[model samples]
Target chain A: MTELKLDQALIKKVISATQNGLPICERPYQRIAEQLGIGEDELIELMQKMLSAGLIRRVGLVPNHYALGYRFNLMTVWDVADQSILALGEKVGQLDFVSHCYQRPRQEPDWHYNLFAMVHGRDEQEVEQQVAQIKQLLGDACRAMTQLNSLKILKKTGLRIRS
Target chain B: MKLSEQDRQLLNRVQQDFPLHPEPFKVLSDQLGVPEQEILDRLRSLEQQNAISRFGAVFNHHRAGASTLAALAIPEHEIEEVAAFVSSFAEVNHNYQREHEFNLWFVVNATDQKGVEKVLNQISATYEYPLLDLPMVKGYHIDLGFPLW
Candidate 1:
């Protein structure tokens, strides 16, 4: 699809309208459109434009991984040689068990990790095994690694924008 | 919670994509070979069971607005007070106390980069702790759904 200029006003309205999940009904889109004071086709067209513009990632069911029994979700950070980060990051991202992977900036002295990957598993052993695979992939390039296990959740409301 | 084979299939299907049609659930019903009413019922039940947290659009925060992953090192005794203060901001979402020296980690999101910086600066000034602000340099993956067997 060709790149299209997004209408910010319409996009904001659509996001504010659907941020709290779509209504579970036969004509969900139509209902949302009606509430937003637009026709169903117009609403869908705006959504399509946003999706094409990479504003909306996906429209789907977001599962609660922890509630689904994948109890251990660890943010595994690795400090690998700068030269090999791009290659190693690609390999680590392809792992079925690694849901999110990115190369973030490193805070020197205090933080040396540049590669971050999120590993999910049913138990500690499973998470450890997954982390081991990443370690093995990095091999000599990986100088240090740490698993940040969440001890407590202080807040967890997903992304929101003021209407 | 024990998941039936059908439940697993439904979960796997919906996570990948949801149709953007007048009757979106009905499209899913056709694809999954389950009746429309039954699919709706299953989704409602799964949400009630907390298996499905949300069933809608997942916006790309970086594209829609601005955000960054930030962490602060809070003294053990003062974690509670520090966390409460940090969580008071509407822009601070997904705050957690992790097992690390940089214990208190959270995501700050706002409509623009200036808004995000204002929140972070305010929080930093409020507390006299070391704050590490890390933003994404590159992303290797996007919209990859988890597969449940």
Candidate 2:
């Protein structure tokens, strides 16, 4: 069960501390708790609470895609039927290679990409093949598609939330 | 550096359903038949190798703040200069160059919509390029839980 209401202050503290990572140790949360001056049990309880509330997406390892030999990151966008997005989006999101998928606003005139999914692979061909598979899955419902290959990483930082 | 069988397994296992305990490492050790100390050390070393970006909670941006995926068609000549200016902002996280006329794309997250707009306006004015602020209308596949192996 999720928390009825999240404790805002505690959420900020836990997130800020673990923003970088949960320090690798015998008792990682315990170490963080000691710094926060809360008991290990309390820290764990708070973490569990946040995790349940859907605030914390996942409490686990995030392997660097590039390091894992997933050098190709294609920002694949599709113009799918608006009514069918909910049903179709969930299916696409479930794909193993598609790391992130969302239906974003369509900036008309210049941009009309609504459904966005991040496809990752060891190389461009692999990524394209995956995209083709998605295209096959989409069938006629899929209008236009574009594969935006990442050229360079100008910056990479996590989202900061201040309470 | 090649990954040992144990390392590969650990990497695959930790991607999803990681243990939730005072000593999660102990749980991993118990399951994998490895020492808890080794689990911790291996994770640390993997992190050091930049293989594991981090082992922690991923916050939901929609719940926590106002975020948008904005793109700018920066002139080829001004790519470097423009990228520097955009990446300078703290709110601007995950900036990257893509192969397109509307080349540079970045995600901006702020505490509120006002803050998000402020960043968008600044970039729009500075670069003199139309910024396509494409905020998520519906989130279908936000979770990226999958097996690495």
Candidate 3:
């Protein structure tokens, strides 16, 4: 990993710039540069660096899932066989319906599933059908639990470099 | 670094809820009294500058189907490998390396509880590590998007 020296001013500017994405314009970066009193090329370079360092995840749009009509949602957990975990994950991630996938540690005594994946569908049956396909792929090495409803939805914001 | 008055207007309009109708851009353009081409051009430019990651439909899995949120503690050395492995699942939506005891966390959405359990079981057998199924008992915050200030 490359060492990054994030200065207070740069961090502040980066956070502010991201918080206020470039106005829809022909040369949005140029406008942001002007607002920050910096050269366009320089600002661009800094953003690139920030991305490379994982300071910012990505500059992208987040669609409203509810508005899109995909109302049914749940998080699934899995315990996959070690030998075929990688191959299985690769095959699963390729599906367009699956939005997010990754692994996490299991807490002792209660946790069992390890491999985690997300799937969406038009309805419960649709999602169930998708999961059935996954089960066919993984055979007996999968266990799961689903959240019938979300009790709360906390703040969803990326990391901001505080000046 | 100059913005035409139209640019400011488009930004203000696009920042809010987008129309669901076909030719939503057209509607926005007419409402904002700007050309559709201009609206699209600015949006494209904004994307190029890393202003917006992507524009598309977002899904609510529970209403649509079944899903679960899970986490596991993976060895630091195997973090990348595990992530890559988990990401391969078609049902896996988003995975992240967080700063926590259960460092390796990922979201899995499936049609039903059985489907999710099957995947987890398979992963455990394959990885030879215990998987903690930390389903979101309570979702404190679910929105993953933030407005650009």
Candidate 4:
């Protein structure tokens, strides 16, 4: 976690405002700062600090893959040996086709998959082909894996830090 | 939506190395060899069209707070009812129906593990279904945003 010691109230306010996203204008920081009644320079500096602290991942446009013609998305989960899972997860995360990769806790008995990677492609066949490549990449290390395609997206929004 | 070459370039370009300046659109405009107003208009239009989900920081959830990927295996008749119930929580960021037997999947986020547990237990009891709580252990990706092209 990012070690934050600044005014917690200010940070919370900033978080709330950022939920609407930065203004799509030349002076977005200024607009947001004005609304929060803080100096623009201070706001920018604080944001920079947050970026360095890993509190904020990026300050940019996040495009929708579906709108961009990459129709198929799959949550590819693998049951990798816990001992070597860390090493394998890091390697798989670096793959260009794999986005949002992580090691997750396993639910025993019924579920054993832990490592997760989100694979998006132009089509289902493309996604399957990428999964095949990942299989080859994992080689003997991957014990088992499965691809779960979304039958429906009830809601697909990021975590909202409400005011 | 048919993306013009310029729109495609803008989408593919801004995923990484987005400027932090007060006038980031200016930097994008410079990169795309267009006026700042054009970049602003394009982004606004893209967002309105739902082509851009968000236009700011995509924070690391675990770093920001606690989160868990949870699932519930509900019968077909109860799918809609359960999905709606799960989606009602402000804590649930993502909820989806998957093809697996453990069909319903959702991510719950909170300030701490206790908060997460509170919601999980409540959901489990209210819906009368066992939730497979899979908290994230570690991140392997910097999430250098997915390539749009």
Top candidate when judged by lDDT against the true structure: 1
Every candidate's CA RMSD:
1.6, 1.7, 15.2, 1.8
Higher-scoring candidate on TM-score, 1 or 2: 1
Query: Top TM-score: which candidate number?
Result: 1
- The list of candidate 1 runs beyond 4 A from truth reads A1-4
> How would you order the candidates by lDDT, starting with the best?
1, 2, 4, 3
**How do the residues B1-149 of candidate 3 rate in per-residue lDDT, one tens digit apiece?**
23345543454455435443335567777887778787787777655554453343223344333566666677878877777788777667666666545666566766578878887887787787656676643221233342211
C-alpha lDDT of residue B125 in model 4: 85
lDDT of 4 by residue, B1-149 (tens): 66778888888788766787777788778877988888878878888888887777667677777889999999999999999989998899899999988999999988778889988998988988767988878889856686655
TM match of model 2 to true structure: 0.95
Q: Which should have the higher TM-score, number 2 or number 3?
A: 2
Clashes of each: 0, 0, 107, 0
Candidate 4 B-chain TM-score: 0.90
Candidate 2 regions with alpha-carbon error over 4 angstroms: A1-4
Interface RMSD after interface superposition, model 2? 1.4
Cα-based lDDT at residue A162, candidate 2: 62
Q: What share of the true interface contacts does each candidate keep?
A: 0.82, 0.83, 0.06, 0.80
Order of the predicted models by TM-score, top scorer first: 1, 2, 4, 3
TM-score on alpha carbons, each prediction: 0.96, 0.95, 0.50, 0.94
After TM-score superposition, the amount by which residue A57's alpha carbon in candidate 4 deviates from its true location, in angstroms, is: 1.0
DockQ of each: 0.79, 0.77, 0.06, 0.73
